[model samples]
Target: MTLLAGTWDGVYRTTGPRFDAAEQVLDCGRVLRVRQFDAFDGVFAATKSGLYHSTDDGDSWTDLDVPREEVYSVVGSPDGDRLYAGTHPAHLYVSESGEEREDDSRSWRELESFQDLPSREEWYTPRHRNEAHVRSLGAHLDVPERVIAGVEVGGVHVSDDRGETWEERKDGVHDDVHHVLVRGPDHYVASCGGGLYRTRDAGESWTRLDDSLDQTYFREAFAHDGVLYAAAARSSPGTWRGERGADAALFESVDDGDSFDVVEYPGHPEEVVLSWTVGDDTIVAGTNDGGVILRDGGEWVEGGRVEAGVAALCAL
Candidate 1:
């Protein structure tokens, strides 16, 4: 299988079981997300430079011309007719024609309703000069009108009418959300800086799931074949560069979010797993230290390494 790694330097491609031969394909800087949805025909990379689309696997990419250059998150509508992009300044934009339109015809319009959230005034962080970012975006095929957004230092919010209106869902969950993993029409897992949360009623209510673990800061969560996987560091990114490194841990859950068992891997306390994708029969993961590893038959195996820290991954 071919794997794509979105890293701080650029986008890399490798055919693995091993990724020693991974090569840079796109020079876009600081890729935060590399994703492919079943409803969309191409892969998308959200980067500091801009939002890009790759129709020919990871070989080539096209800039989607999002109004803002620092796109942090992207998602497609359930029917693939629309596209949504979230920027570094905590702004939301929607493209009515998606990527199917000609270059000249395609356009993105700002979703001003998102700025009207009740907690908008509190969406700042000292890390980014008191500015926030829309770090994650998600949409479920079962609910086309529903769009969920996770803002870094902001909060988790939902739009039931496809970005036309929004409601705050951050009451029970932490405000520093990093990623929102959509599992069903009304079910989601929010990986936050303070904790990992799950909502069963489309964000109306949430439950913390990381109380049994030592790690409090989470980047992303993945669910496949009834198994849930998550990785987290002891604290935020500022503490990730010390002698002990990230002090990270990887957790596996077979009973949804009820409980978790820490899994041992190569770079235990030094490297944190930042991205995940499924191959033919193995679960592939990318780490902040540029390490690639896979799980086969319940055993973790090393899968070579890339040149730069992998922030996101996609398997095809």
Candidate 2:
């Protein structure tokens, strides 16, 4: 499924050039984030217009009840007991039915304490509005008690008690977090506007891995079997209004983001690669220029374009 970012075409599930509507109706707005939790057998999408839920994979989706008008990130607990939604202006809302379901039966409760994190007054976006937004949310597979929220221009906020309390994580490090991928209790990667960072001590310290690449603007990243894949551009998306578009470079780190080398593809994304999905033996990348490239058998292949820009892609 492709979460269209450039227009209100909403989300679509595609098989090569053929595609089908995945949302309830038209003009569902641009989807900023899409997450799938196997524990719940569900998929959630945070869009500019509203939030959505899908139970039977990507076949259908319905708008879920949310208080905010713009949501940036959505993630579920490891046990599927609770669902978390992060929205614009950096607000966090949670719902818990103690059981996972397909509909909006769970009661959502806002966690106002999230705004109390450190240096919140310093959070400001340079290109757009001054206020920050929660762009990425993550949870450890083994350690269910620990969760994290990556707020753009606001640094990282971690909760050890499942979002009951929060603490800011940043020291001698850059913020503007774009995405966070938590693998285990101690291993995680933060794809930030500054560069790619990885923490082995659970956010205690982050080591910048892009000092050599010189491509610091990182948006999307994923790690599997100790191999890390990331999308890097010269700058952020908000500043990409030039006629030249963007210069996105794909990189792979064999040592868990300690170092990276460029990877070539068929339709090398001249724009930013903002979405990534890993299949059984394939890895797919979606670019800001509405390009979808797949890597299988060590060769890159152009799948197709969504025409509305691909922000998020997941195997359903």
Candidate 3:
């Protein structure tokens, strides 16, 4: 079953080029932040107001009852029966029933604090509702107890009891983390304002890996076929505008996050944001501009472009 995508104003089926704006699945106003669209069971979106779910192939959506609207990220369990939503002003919300929010059976499970990391209220600073956005999330395939959340202003948080309690990993990680990816049993990568960083000790300590990459804005990172890939955008020193400057191509890092090699695309180096590996060899990249590019085999194909821009992409 192929999934659908389009501008924030509309939604489209992946099998065709035509789009139906009537089926604009997600709302942009109430949702201050939206992340993690799982196309298999449904799409999971987090907003500053609350959480939303779209199950009718992105035709419509419902809001999940959450404590706060400042949700940074949403992660689904391997079974797709439940989801873990992380909020800024730091809070963890769990939905045991991963169904439409309209479903009354769904309940919100809030997790208590973990480790000696400062509480969310203690680190309260004025920033965008999304400023403390949960930048990245990953669940261990082999170890079900392990879950990780990368916060923008805060460092990393790990939950071993499936979101029951959280612990902050403050060793070698930068306080400002842009994204995170779990590579293996003992390794993880984080992209930050400083550059690419790797931690062999489960985020306890990190090592900088920016020497091979041109100093640019590291927007997003992901893993595919056991190879690490990061997407970055070249920016002007003053303001972060892609229209006035050239963006960087995608990069591949084979040896964990130590180094990188830029991947070539069809157009001039354009910036790409969120991406996901659909199959063993397919990658779908969502660009800042409302465009989607699919990488199959050794080539890239333009899926479509939306005026409002592409926020995120995931395989169905």
User: Sorted by lDDT, highest first, which candidate order results?
Assistant: 1, 2, 3
Give lDDT for model 3: 0.61
Kindly report which residue pairs in candidate 2 clash with one another: none
Q: Which candidate gets the maximum TM-score versus the true structure?
A: 1
Backbone clashes counted, model 1: 0
- lDDT to native, each model: 0.90, 0.74, 0.61
Sequence-dependent TM-score of model 1: 0.97
> Model 3: runs farther than 4 Å from truth?
6-13, 16-23, 30-40, 79-82, 97-105, 114-116, 119-131, 235-238, 242-246, 266-270, 279-281
User: For each predicted model, how many residue pairs clash, with residues at least 3 apart or on different chains?
Assistant: 0, 0, 4
Q: List, residue by residue over 1-316, the lDDT tens digit for candidate 2.
A: 3332222357766543212333322256787876788777667778888778777656666777767879889888888777888888878999885533456445578887887776888878756477888899899778887778888888877888989898877664577888988877877788888888888777888888888885789987887666888878788776565665566688887877777779887545466778877655467777776677777666667766665777887665
Better of 1 and 2 by lDDT: 1
For residues 102-126, could you state the per-residue lDDT of candidate 3 as single tens digits?
Answer: 4632577776563235645333335
Q: What is the lDDT of residue 87 in candidate 2?
A: 86
For every model shown, what is its TM-score relative to the native structure?
Answer: 0.97, 0.90, 0.80
Local distance difference test, candidate 2? 0.74
